[model samples]
Target: MKILITGGAGFLGLHLAKYFSEHFVGNKDFCSLLDIAEFDKKEYPKNCHFIKADIRNSTLMYQYIKSMDYVIHAAAALPLWKEKDIFDINVGGTKNILEASFKNKVKRVIYVSSTAVYGVPKKHPIYENDRRVGVGSYGQSKIEAENLCFSYIKKGLNVTIIRPKTFLGTHRLGVFEILFDWIHDGKKIPVVGSGNNRYQLLDVDDLVEAIYLFVVRSGHPQGVQRQQGHPKGDLIYNGAFNIGAEKFTTVKKDLEKVFIYASSERSESRSHNKNSSRQARTISKVFPTPAFFVKKALWLFEKLKLSPLYQWVYDTADKDSFVSVKRLTETLN
Candidate 1:
């Protein structure tokens, strides 16, 4: 089938493009991507096509989408940004996708929505059936995008919505990139208070598997019709999965481990102060490191009007954040 992925230069988009190119070889149907970035032809798949364009360009995107069999809409704004950018793109752009798909008569359009669509998880296992409410503009925008899908479904667009948790693996690398980069850079990892907050993160590979299932399922090609008793040609999924070393991790304790692992590679920790078990003992688990703590402390200092220490702390803590991923198992499966 001819497939097109939007925001194809982003991490998840790149992975999806690779997956489709390598796995779908029948008739060697086009596996193309649309985004504003240029593809490195020398390094990227030769057979796969890449079209540079903004998702909001309705006229261009609408005309371009006409020849495809399916679309994987992975474009959107994260919850960490200003609200207006989020609305202008995710909401408006989604409406445009639906319009283009409808006009072109594309087979299936898989929307890679976010757990942000649900704001914070109220229940341990948030199912596809749970209510969607958001805290900030990020979540609010996601909610709007999801509603857009349903709106298209009402108009007879074949749509499927997947709400994913803190998924990681490639380009985007989750939020954990900060921690990894910190440890690698010989900096102390910061931890929040005791670092006990947990979050569910899914592997992008596993998420790709789920997307494959929903998209290829038997359904109408032209999307769900309007005035429906129930959405006739759509699938909704809560994308939660546990792919971390453990289901949960603490900040302070985890950061300590990472720091020990990173610093102990020096062979000097053996001679340095070894009296305090927490101080000298090498951490064995995957989590945040001392730099994570240092980061939080710095953030605190900045908030409290502290001096030089605040700047140092901010530098180290720039990447010190964590989330629990245990709840993912219940939601995705």
Candidate 2:
């Protein structure tokens, strides 16, 4: 079947492209990658087609989405920008894709939403029906964009919404680079707060598998419906699912793991030298940057356009934000 993926050169999108390419290579009509920027040919499968186009171009969206079996709306303005005028790309672009998909009768659309829509949750293990008070402009735009998907769904579009948290894997390089760099350089790793708050992070490999489950799986098992709202006797599983890992770790412990891994590699590399010490370098203490200080620094960085973490990371760093994946697990099973 033909499939179209927007923002195909992005971190998550790149992983999705590689996953589909390896799984469906040699079928030239299997998949197409659409992005505003050009991609490296050597990085993609031999058969996948690459299209340089913006999703905001309604005509382009129509021309490409036409006659496609599946469309994954993964393009969005991540919160790295100095300004928050992302409605054109985040909300308006989604509207264009959905309108085109509806007109062309696309079979299924995997709309990738984010955990940012939930803002700072007041409770742990946030559910799908939890409050959707967005924190920043990026979050606000995502909420609006998600509403567009549901609007199309009401018009008979089979759209599945996947809300994933801060996913990490090999392709991750933006904010994560800070951690990797500090760890590799044997510098003190900084934690935003007291580091007791637990953060849920899903591996990209696991996230891709979950997306595969949604695409291939059909009908939920009996008595598996766990939605909070819907009329009685209606067993339809709403196509929305919050994707997160079951296990969670404190920010401090997670950074320590990175430190340990980096130290091991350093030790192994230096072992050949007779002057190298036998003991591994361990970081016994962490630099604890207060949340208020981080916020102030982020504000200044945004003004100066010198920071990559920006407002999104600072807004949620000290908060306990995690989703309940029980619904997703049951549906997949």
Candidate 3:
């Protein structure tokens, strides 16, 4: 199927684009990207076209989107601590994508919404049925965008919304890096409240898989309505699932754990000089490696609470949300 992925160069978008391109490969009729930022062609599987245009430009969007079978609206400005101007970008940008999708005769739209739509929840594991009470500018704008999608859905547009939890990938700039860096530097990761605030993070890989399945199923003309697994048309389902590893570790605990885990490796050499008082030439180099050095730097930064990356952990504290998801299987892999 011909497809268009907005913000294709972004962290999540890049992964999803690669995921689809690999699965579809040469057989795809067309799978293009639309983003104002230039897409790195090297990262992509094929020489797919990327239209550098913002979603806010309706005229340009409409011109390009008039006949796409699938529209994955992955474009949006993320939530910020402060708002510069709301009209032209976040809120308006969403409207532009939805309206263009409608005009384009796009069969389905797999909207990548945020769990922020349900802000400062009164309950843990924020379900799709829960009330949406956003906290600040970011959440508020997402709610507006979600409403636009629903409004379009009311007009008979096939819309499937996926709200992602805290996401981590190879090339992201939000908050997770700070904590990881802090842990690397051998520093204490600060916990906002009690440190028991369990949260789930979507690795970019898993999120891409979820989006792929959602897109393929939502747009499949031969899609069957199986109540147990596959999502149906004109329906709303929670896309963000609890996806962090073994167990949820607090900021402080996570740092200590990571440092301990990394440093726990045993030194291989020194057996020959085990209990001797002899001059030993160095050979068993384990600690003080570049990776080790970087981790140490991160630790120092986290302790100081000076690094912007470390501050990201401080930000995650206020967000009280986690995902409880159903495992989605991929046919491609």
Candidate 4:
């Protein structure tokens, strides 16, 4: 099977490329990586082929996707960018990919959507059908992209949409990088408010596994098509599935673990469950930052065009942003 991954040089795209190259090793199993940015060849497996091109290029997208069995559409203009730039890549690029996939008859395309479509979620365990009131243009663009996927689906294109939460692990940067830096410098980690809000995060490994499941099980015998009386059985997963960890922990507890393990090499072993008692002790040292002041600072940062993660922290600082994965689990089974 020939698989093409858009945004292949990116964090999640690179991870998926590496996974497919290492695990899907049949001679016929070829992997193609597409991205506008150039990547270090040594970082990827020899089986993975790289193609540098913008997803907005319909001709190029069609050229590469024509012979591919599957596509993982992970390209997007992340938050905190110019509004026009966000929409162009997030929405326009998606349109190009969907159009090319449809024209080329790709078997199935996994659209890597985002949980940001929920936008400052007001409810816990946010469901797939929940209203999407995107916080910013980036989130709104994601919703637009998903709508585009549905449009293509109506034309008989097989697509599965996976809305993932803020995922971490290899190639993580931005706010997460700040956490690691603070830990290395022995600086106090900032916590907005009591840091008790429950925020869910997905590990990149888990996310890769979820996408792999869709790739391996392109057919479904368990559930009916979302569209009424549709002839195709499991060719597509209509709508979207919220992807996150099954279990959730409060922000403070998560930070405690980060601090404990990241502070020193010796403390790494203590992060395991075997040292739960010791972890409990470290939790007490968690610092607190008043949400009121943080909000004010965020406002200034926005005006000054500062880091994007600050706005993210301000929005989710005192809220529960976890999601339900019940539908995903059932689909995987």
lDDT winner among the candidates? 4
lDDT by residue (tens digit), candidate 4, 214-306: 876674332343333656556546568889998879998987877666555435645555644433223225678888888888878886887
Model 2 is weakest, by summed lDDT over 10 consecutive residues, at 218-227
Tens digits of per-residue lDDT for model 1, 135-210: 5566677788888788777777777776665566865554477766666556554443334544344678877876
**CA shift of 146, model 3, Å:** 0.4
Ranking according to TM-score, highest score first: 2, 4, 3, 1
TM-score of 1: 0.69
Q: Which tens-of-lDDT digit does each residue in 1-333 have in candidate 3?
A: 788889888877778777787888676547888888877778876746778897888898888788788888888775432364443566788788778888777877878877767766667765666788665666777777788878888887777777777677786656667755554444444444554556566677877777676666554654434333544432433233223232464443544455655444212223544654432232121122233344456557755755543323334453455754543232222
Prediction-by-prediction clash tally: 32, 0, 5, 0
What TM-score does each of the candidates earn? 0.69, 0.88, 0.74, 0.88
Which window of ten consecutive residues has the lowest lDDT sum in model 4?
275-284
Give lDDT: candidate 4, residue 310: 34
Q: What's the CA error at residue 76 for candidate 2, in Å?
A: 0.9
Give the backbone clash total of model 4: 0
* Candidate 4 TM-score, true structure as reference: 0.88
lDDT of each: 0.63, 0.78, 0.64, 0.80
Q: Give per-residue CA lDDT, model 2, range 1-333, as digits (tens).
A: 788889888887788878877776577758888999778767777777889999889999999999787888898887754234488899999999999999998877888999888887779889988889876778888899989988898998878888998888885577787767667667776678887788888899888877765654422223224333446222233457899878878887777777777777877777767576544465434678889988898889876878766566777788786899988887666
